[model samples]
Target: MARSLVDLLTTHAAHQPERTAYRYLATGDCDGEVQELSYARLATRSRAVAAWLQERGLAGSRAMLLYPPGPEFISGYLGCLSAGVVAVPGVPPQGRSQNHRALTRMKRLIADSDAKVILGGHEVIAALGRLAEHLPELDGITCVATEDIPDEMAAAWREPDLTADSVAFLQYTSGSTSAPRGVVVTHGNLLDNQRVITERMGHTPDVIAGCGGELFVSWLPVYHDMGLIGPVLNTLYLGVTATLFSPLHFLQRPDRWLTAISRYRPHTSGGPNFAYELALKHAKPALLDSLDLSSWKVAFNGAEPVRAATLRRFTETFAPAGFRGEALYPCYGLAEATLMVTGGTVGVPPVLLEPETGAADAAAVGCGRPGEGVTVVIADPEGPRELPEGEIGEIWVRSASVAKGYWRNTLATRESFRATLPGHEGRFLRTGDLGFLRDGELFVTGRLKDLMVVDGRNHYPQDLELSAETCHPALRPGCTAAFSVDRGIEGERPVLIAELAPEAVGESEKITDLIRAAIGDAHGLSVHDVVLVHPGTIPKTSSGKIQRGASRAAYLDGTLAPVGATAVR
Candidate 1:
């Protein structure tokens, strides 16, 4: 296995040092102008960064990379690995008002590692610098600009040898409010997962992928798991060429993702269900008519719930643009597993199934079976028994590819690695997701633990959505949301958010009550907060999972005032 990320770049540099590894697709008058780096160029830059860190007596220490998506991100990451300093990626605070809290998490992570150096672009460097001005723990900050690589930096001496088992980088992920956990990713973990991905996805060593080139565009936030480690790191692993655009670029014009796909003819790319839906909602007819997706081979769909209807409608709409239904690959993964856990067989069509059906119902949409080197089990929470093919169970995965543990939190690490295999020989990673194995294929259900339990029975929010639209013409089917707030020992009470159709904007609460009655009758659950918002008012993450966690946080902080509730806080 390749020891470090630098090794991946170095090997590629040796094979095709002159080939374009990354391309920055511009938006201004320089729209056509591309900023690219050959493997040689990247290695040269990395060496400079390593030497700079060494000169500051911060070599072998941990540092944070807080820059936005660009070649600088690539350089900042690889430079730390090359220098033997642990690399920690910085995440932008989601709650604008809670920026300092986000910084506190970053600060805690850095302090835990005893890291003193921070590497970033002007913006992140500036923000952290200001934070450092008050927090005495933070040390020197280095702005590694792609355009300003000094001559001395280019010729600086390389650092010590890195190994397969050596710690490469630390990836931060969401946890309880009290503590932040970082997934400690090693060089071995990266190399193993990359091999699995490259072999399954069919990226040849000789392939010259365009940087989001030949036909496609992506506006996924570079900070996201799928965005950062999935695409950017995967590109380096297989040596594919791709275009880089900030996640905001797509938010501004989601059509750009399609426009870029149609324009670039990219062989592989895709995001969550919401992205495809957004493109359909935002893109003009003329633009859709002019685009084409036929050249795209692997449109990976995972990270969040993969809705069958969403995939079906997308292929039906984009058919005119040469989008083939067979290119959809519905997969499952999380950062804890180093990215992908189980993916739909690449180059296979997605398996279609009714969302209302739990694992007990089996259907196929051409999403092929699982790959070798991975084992998937559907286990009931009451005990360690595999459910029948059609039974819904918490999806537990055991793989040599699983990550080591969360950094600095051994308790969480132990809890995260409990396995369900017979005799309990080893441990498995609990995904907290629900899915079923059918006809040797996998169909994902909603979260196993996210179900809303009222009285004594269990109810899925999706089922409420699928049934509610029939009761009221104004309510958008499948757009309805149901969640619960803690009510102590009595369990949790339900709340619903249903988006009104464009025509039914006038009728909100009456339609809400009707739908609420329908849901109450069907599921025997009471939805106290029947929020009636516009079609797109509900926020979603880049990968398309409704950020239930973020939404709850918003509601608690008073940013979101549902139909009728006391002001939060």
Candidate 2:
């Protein structure tokens, strides 16, 4: 009777077996161009796909999945889970300058994975072939059909008897280069968190979002946890119609996500901080005027640090669209924890403290409370001891959902999970994030290793970015980054990179000077360098995080800076 992730998913399949469990590539028509799969149907498809693999002598095979957002991707992912195959999700193709690196790294991962077959759609396979031109090793990968998908393949298992500790999937996180690390999560880990999210999302009577109300609407890439699990998995267990869209399609046309919501009347939507910022920048004013966003209930912000100004401006701009101020929900999560760590209470306005920099003591937007069987504690990392609630320290989590650890790296697994928290019975996952608890909720600050020591006082790059963008007329708020210069010298102060208004390109000197003076006077943090780039020039992850490492590398290599940008720095 032990619980397992496969059991958990199958349970949902049993509950409302005929209810629509997943909709891939939804259209705006009355019936919509949706590829609807009921829980029963999905379960059948998953087992059949697994069976197909077994018949082809591919059971327990290692495979890499590379496809854009759609039904085929989901089916492939589930089939891998069902067959106990090692599923390695590929990062979507970045631009030309970055594609080679992505391809090369992907080839290495495939090689390291010993993947027997590469499952992808036609277009993805074609792209893989092109990538092979850059990386010769890619040619050996057996590119095969993921679609024409055996309309009626037999089931893999006649009866389901899944174990809690079986390998479920490999979650990849970006490293400095295009290469990423794969974090192994097990069945127990996925189920524990899925159950937690089901409760956290307020499903007493089964929280449901109809076409226009409380529905799950998202455009984040499925390669990410928030996209695959957040709205997708959460909605399924709750029977809410999860309206899906691809971030790629949205990025190509920013209005689609909002337009879908306005038309579908979906109340629940989530994305990283960058999505909201992009909406403010790229969303047409005419589209904004017509958006019926009053139904928006929970706007879960996570994946990256939440910027206060970005949240504020988003609320203000969307207010005209009937979006309420309280609709903005600032939360925190990571794939290592399955998806959501701490989320704001359902149907309540979120907690918004001062801007990250304004608070000298370093306060964060609270991530609400620990969800089902999950324990969170802030401890002094020098040794395991509880710190005062208001004081900052490392955030440690112990939960049924916390993963076993990185797959092949015993050292990393040993480092990440250990018996530390006094209240918890099991080992904890050191999130590598610094934050604290207040009252009863968790608040995320920043990464432990990334904290910059400027002139003896501790400073965070996020903090500096907040100060740079604050109350600026020309520069949009919360669109800045501060990082210490490792200029091959000691005691190098941090640089300020602010996103300037397109029209204010000529006012670079004044903007930089203003940013420098403000940081120097307010926080006593001197700006060693100042650079102005067009908005969005600084690379961000799919979750909308400022790639500080990437930006720093670009700055050091002299690739990101513009012609006149050198004048100020």
Candidate 1 lDDT over 332-414, as tens digits, reads 77777777766666556766664354421222333345556767777886677778887878877776667788887888888
Q: Which tens-of-lDDT digit does each residue in 384-435 have in candidate 2?
A: 7878888889898888778777766678778877647654566788888899
Deviation of model 1 at 361, angstroms? 15
lDDT of 2 at 307: 68
Candidate lDDT values, in order: 0.67, 0.71
Lowest-sum lDDT 10-residue window in model 2: 205-214
Model 1's alpha-carbon lDDT is 0.67
Candidate 1 lDDT score at position 378 = 79
The TM-scores of all predictions, comma-separated, are 0.85, 0.89
